[model samples]
Target: MMVLPFLVAGWIFLVGVYGMVTSRNAIHAIGCLAVAQSSTYVLLLTVGYRRAATAPYFTDTPLRTRVVDPVVQALALTDVVVGATVTASLLALALQVRKRHGTVDPDALTGLRG
Candidate 1:
């Protein structure tokens, strides 16, 4: 069970990288980048998981307090937010390119030559 998430994340990361390398459109490339980032987020979140860990919260139970690792959870949450913001920014840029140039294909986006 613990390994399932890792496997899925790794597969997604590989697929993302492959897509980035093979994609011809700028929008597709950005989507691939997002996929890669999402995979890493999943991996980090899985790292915080334990076989039988309790939720990280204020509780009187010493075992519960000891079970959860706050650091990993915090880092994962921060990364998730940052990744989302970056993905949105990249997608916006792609949209702007399409609007201004009328094409999202990198090869077709040749700028005016002097």
Candidate 2:
């Protein structure tokens, strides 16, 4: 059970990497990069998950029972925000590249050098 999440995350990462590598369009590559970034969230969530764990609230439940780690969830949220920011920035850059070059093809981007 513990290994399943890791395997899934690895598979997602590989698929995203393959997409990026095989993509001809800059926008497509950026999307693939975002997909690659999503694997981190899965890994973090999986790491934070605890079987039969309850919320950290001080309800009728005792303090000794299993409770998932809040820190990892927070980290995952932070990662998501960072990923969104990066994706937005990359997309904007890609748009600019497309406007300047009139094409989003990676191979035709050689003339973009300074």
Candidate 3:
């Protein structure tokens, strides 16, 4: 079960990277980048997983009881927010590039010497 998450995360990340590398459109590349960034969430969740571990809350459990790492969970949540923000900003930039250059293709945009 533990290995499954890692494998899935690796696959997702690799696929996203491949898409980004092969994509011809700027918007598609940004979407691929967002997909790659999402893999971090799965990885972080897997890291926080604990066999037979209870929640981080102290209620109904002793202070020393085994519990999943709250820090990892917090980091994962923060990463989600950061990823969304980055994706939105990148997409907005791509939109502006399309409007200014009249094309979203990276190859076509290369001629923008000015």
Candidate 4:
């Protein structure tokens, strides 16, 4: 199997994490979180990829033909959906934070009240 895709995914994940760690604003952190979540799509696709493999549709292929894994593809799709949902939720929460606190800076919101 090729190692490049895995390396690329890892690099992307690290970049996102670094961005999240250094981000000051809540919106920026949410964007970084989404970027981090996106790396899973690349990882899943890389894991499911097969050289010279056809699509997962088995309607016309022979019994022994190589086909990419459908499960991983499904998982990647699910990851995308979940990522979008999480991002949206975080964005909404950030909006609420800005509305209530008048700022989205992480350092400025240290005294959050319940």
Q: Kindly report which residue pairs in candidate 4 clash with one another.
A: none
- Per-residue lDDT tens digits of candidate 1, residues 11-105? 99999999999999887898898888889778887887776777777656674354667788888889889988998898898898889999888
Cα error, residue 34 of model 3, in Å, equals 0.7
Question: What C-alpha root-mean-square deviation, in Å, does candidate 2 show against the real structure?
Answer: 1.6
Candidate 4 local lDDT, 11-112, one digit each (tens): 989999999999999999999989988989999999999999999998889999999999999999999999999999999999999998899998899678
Q: List the global CA lDDT of all models.
A: 0.84, 0.92, 0.93, 0.93
What is the TM-score (0 to 1) of candidate 3? 0.91
* Per-residue lDDT value at 91 in model 3: 94
Native-to-model Cα distance after best TM-score fit, residue 50 in candidate 3, in Å: 0.2
> Compared with the true structure, what per-residue lDDT tens digits does model 3 show for residues 1-114?
669999999999999999999999999999999999999999999999999999898777887789999999999999999999999999999999988999999888876767
For candidate 2, write residues 1-114 as lDDT tens digits: 689999999999999999999999989999999999999999999999999998766668775888989899899999999999999999999999888889999888889667
Native-referenced Cα lDDT, model 3: 0.93
Shift of residue 38 alpha carbon in model 4, Å = 0.8
Candidate 3: which pairs clash? none
Per-model TM values vs. the true structure: 0.82, 0.92, 0.91, 0.96
Best by TM-score: 4
Which lDDT value does model 2 have at 23?
98
Answer with 3 or 4, whichever has the higher TM-score. Answer: 4
